[model samples]
Target: MIDAAEHRVVDCDWHYQDSFTDIVEYMEEPWKTKYEKSNWDAAGVKQNLSSFFPTSTGDRQAYGKIEREHSNYPDKAETPDRVREGMEFLDVDQSIQISHLALAMGGVQTDDERTQAFAKAHIEYMLEEVLDPDDGVYGLAPLPYSDIETSLEILDRVENEPAIKGACFITAGANPPLGNRKYDPLYKRCEEIGYPVVFHTGGSGLDDYVRAGYQEMLETHTLGFLESNMSQLVSVTCQGVPEKFPDLDIVFMESGVTYVPGLISRLEEEYLKRPEEAPLLEKRPSEYITDYYFGTQPLEVSASPDLLELCFDMLGTDRLLYASDYPHWDFDSPSTITDLPFISDEERKAILAGNAVEVFDL
Candidate 1:
C-alpha cells in the first residue's frame, strides 16, 4: 500500500474484469446457459486462434504470461472490494473501470450471438458488481464496434447513469477502424451525449499485419499494444474524427506517451503537405491530441529520462492522466510518476488528479 501524499489521485484506467464465465453469469439468454453448461473462453471449447498464428492465450502469450507467471487473473483480481483495497492503497480518489475480456473476444467469436450476449452480460456485471459502488469507481462502458445496434442500445441504457462517465470501443482488428463511416453513429451520439470514449486495445484482437512472421510473446507484448492504438490514433486524427465530433475526448490507454509526439509530428508533416486531403481538420494534428488524454502505465523507463522529459514538455500538463494499469503485470503507480525527476511538482499534481477531474468531469 502506497500513500499518495494526500494528493487527489485519479487513476484514469483500472481493469476489474474477470473470465468470460464471470460475465456470462449476468447474461439473460441462452448464452448464459451455454457458458455455464459448456466451458467457454477455455481450451478446446474455443481456442486462441491468433496466439497460434503468433502467440495466443493457450500458448506463450502476453496476457497468459501475466496470469500464469505474474498471478494477475483479471476476474479473480478485479472485485469491488478488491479494487477498493487497491484504491485505498494507492490513495486513488477516482478511477475508471474499463472492460477487457469481453472486448478482447469482440471478433474472435465464431458465433456472433455469443459475442452479443457476452458484451451485454459484461456490461450488466460491471454495472452491478464492479461499477455499482458509486464510490469514485467510474464506469467506462465498453461498446463493441462490431455490434453497432447492441452498442447503441447499451449506450442509451447508461446515457444517464450518474457514475457512468464515458464509453470505449476496443481496437484490435483494422476491419472497422474508428474513422470508418459506419462507426459515425456511435461517435456522433457520444459527442452529443457528452460521453468521452476511452479507446483501448492490444494483444488479442490484432490485424493480420501484426501477427505476420511474429514469434514470441515479448515481441507482441512490447509492440502489439502500441500498434493497435497507433492505427486508431492515425485514423481518428487524419480522417478528422476529432474535428467532426469536437466534444469527443479519447484517452489512449496502456500505450506510452513517448510515441505520441512522433506520431503527431508525422501527421502534421503529411497534413501540411496535403492540407487539401483533410479539409475538415481545423488545426495542427498535435492540437487535436490535447483534446485527448493518456494513461501512464508501462511508464517509459529510458536510460536517459530526458526522452520522457521531452515528451511531457511537448504535450503539456492538461491531458496526461495517472494510471496504474492495476491488477496487470505492468502496473504503474505513484512512485513511477512522482519519482520522475523531470516532472515538476505542479505537473505531477496535474497528472495525478487535476487533469483527470477536468477531462472526465469527475
Candidate 2:
C-alpha cells in the first residue's frame, strides 16, 4: 500500500517505456513483417541514436546508455520496485504513466484493421505494466488516430477499466487539428464516458521541423510545446470543439506553463481582431484556458513567481497539475521544484498534489 502521506500527491505527468525491442515484440506477425521491412534493425538503431545524441563522443557514450536502459522491459527502469523508488524520492502519492511510444505513434496503418490491432496491443501493454493489480499506478489509453470509428471503439473497450483514467493522443501528427470535425466522434465518446483526453507532445513517426535536422534539436524541443499547444488551442476554440463538447476535459502534458500567459493573451488579441472567427467563444481565450488543465515541470517553476502567481490566480487551483517527468534526461526532480526560492507553501501544496486531485478526480 502507498503511504497515506505520499498518496495525497498526484504526479500529473510521467512516462512509460517503449523500447525498440518491445515494439518488435508486440507487433502482430503480419505487422511484424511490415515493421521489419522498415529499418528497425541495427542500421535503424544507429540512425535513431545519431539523431537523439548528436555529438560524436556523446553519441558513443549514449549508445551504451540507451542499450543498457532500453534493451529490456520490466527491467530495473520499469519495475514496480523502481517506480516505488521514484515515488518515494518525489513524495508523490499516485502517478499516471503516459506512454511515450504509444502517443508518439498514432495510426500505424491508415486501414481500420491494422489500426485497431495496433491500438489494442498498446492498451494491452499499458494494462499489463501499470494497471493490472497495481495499487497506485494508472494509465492513459492510446487511441487509433488513423480511423475515428476504430478509435471510438477502442475508447468504448477501455472506458470502464478502472486502471484507465484517460485517453492519450499525439499533440501533433494527426492529419487535421485535434478539434477537427473528424475527431469529434472520439471527443464525443470521451465526454460521454467522462474520460479526459491527454495531448502529449513529441509524437512518433513525425517528420516535423524538430525531426528534420540536428540544429533544430534545441529549438525543436523548446518550440514544440508552444507550437502544439497553440495549434490545439486555436483548433479547438476556432473550430468549435469545446462548444460541441463542453464537458470534455483536455490536459496538455510535458509543455511548461510559462508561455501559457502569453499564448492566452495572444489568443485573446486575435479573437478581438476577428470576433467572427471565434464567435463560439463565450469569453476571452484565456477563460477557456483557465478551464482546461496544464501539467507543471521544474523548468516551468522557474517563471517569475509574480507572473506565476498571476497566471495561477486566473487559472485557479484546479487547472494545474504537478508532473516530475521522471527517468528522462530532463526529468524534474521533486526537490528541485519544491525548493524553488520563490514558491510558497500553499502554492507548492497545490502544484504538488492538491490541484491534481481535483483535475484527475483522484
Candidate 3:
C-alpha cells in the first residue's frame, strides 16, 4: 500500500468559476461598454449570461440537485488566497488552474476581434489577480483559436510571466482541426517558447455534440470530451503535427483514460494500411501518441484494477499526470492515485506531482 502522507500532489487540471462580471473591468472599450449595459438578469436569459461562451441548459447544481461545500462561492479559486485554501483542503502541493468560463473559447459566436478581446482580457485578469507561481497557483493563458495573429500576440505578452505556464486551446467547436496547416504558426510559437499546448474540453457546447443525437446532458457530458479528444488525436497524428513540431508538448484534459487503448490500436491499424496518406509520419500513430501527455481526471475508478493496469502498461505510467478537476462536482482527489493498488510508490509519486513538475516546468 502507498503511504498517502508522504506523497506530493499536483493538480494539473484545477478550475475556478470565472465570470465576465468579474473580468469586465479587465476588458477593453466598445465591447466593455456594451457588456456593462447588457441586462444579464433579463427574464428567460440563461442563468450564465455573464459568460461569453454558450450556456448549456444542463441542471448541474440547480435546485440543490448537487451540492459542494463552497457552492455559494463557486469562484472560490478566483484569488490566490482562496485558491490556496482549496488546495490545502485537498492536500495538494501545487495546482495548475485552468479556466472554467474560458473553456468555451472555441465556441465563442462573435466577430474575431471581439473574441480576441475576451481572450486577452481573461489572461490579463488571471495574471494580475490570481496567478502566483510562488504560491503554487499557476495558470494557462486562454487563446482565441480562430485568430492566429492575436493568439501569437497573447503568447508574446505572457512569455515573461512565471505563473503563466502555457497556452490553453478550447477543443470544442474548434474549426480546421488542430492538425491543419493554419495552426502551425501557433504550434511553432508555443514550441519556441518552451510551453506546452493544453487542449481543455468543455461540456457547455451541447449543440456541437447534439448533431450526433445526444439530447440530454448525461449523454452529451459523457461523450463530449471523448469525441473532441478522439477527433483531435486522429487529426493531429494523421496530419503529422508531432512530426512537424517535435519539441512542442501537447496535453489533452478532462477526458478519462479508457478510450485511449482502443482508439490508438484502431488508428495504428488504419495508418498501417495508408502510409502514403501521412507522408510526414515516420512512425505508427500509437508511437507518436506516447510523446503526448494526458490528464488523469475522471480517471474511471469503476474499471477493474487489472484492466487499468494494462492501460498503464500500454500508455506508460510516466505519461499520465494527476488532475483533480476541483470545485466541479465530479472532481477527483489525490487519494484517487494514492490508494491505487496497481501503481508502485514511485509511480504514484510521479503521477501526483513529479510528472507535473517536469511537464509545466515548475
- Highest TM-score, which number? 3
Ranked by TM-score from best down, the candidates are 3, 1, 2
lDDT of each: 0.72, 0.64, 0.79
Candidate achieving higher lDDT, 2 or 3: 3
Q: How close is candidate 3 to the true structure, as a TM-score?
A: 0.93
Off by over 4 Å in 1: 1-3, 40-70, 74-77, 106-111, 205-209
What's the number of clashes in each of the models? Answer: 4, 3, 0
- State the displacement of the C-alpha of residue 76, model 2, in Å, after optimal TM-score superposition: 9.3
Error of 2 at 310 (Å): 3.3
Residue lDDT tens for model 1, 1-362: 22376778988888764555567678877766766766344421243443211224323325454553333453243456777877877778788877656446544635356666766777777777777535888878777667778889988988888778888777666466777778888998898788888778655744333555666656666677777788898888778888778778778888878888888888888888988887778888788876778887777876368888878877776778888877666778777777878767888888898988887888
Top lDDT prediction, candidate number: 3
Candidate 3: Cα lDDT at 131 = 81
CA-only RMSD, every prediction: 3.7, 5.0, 2.5
How do the predictions measure up, each by TM-score? 0.87, 0.81, 0.93
List of clashing residue pairs for candidate 3: none
In angstroms, the error of model 2 at 45 is 7.8
**Residue 212's C-alpha lDDT in candidate 3?**
47
Cα lDDT of model 2 by residue, 155-225, tens digit: 88888788788888866556677777888888989898888888776534333433454343345556655
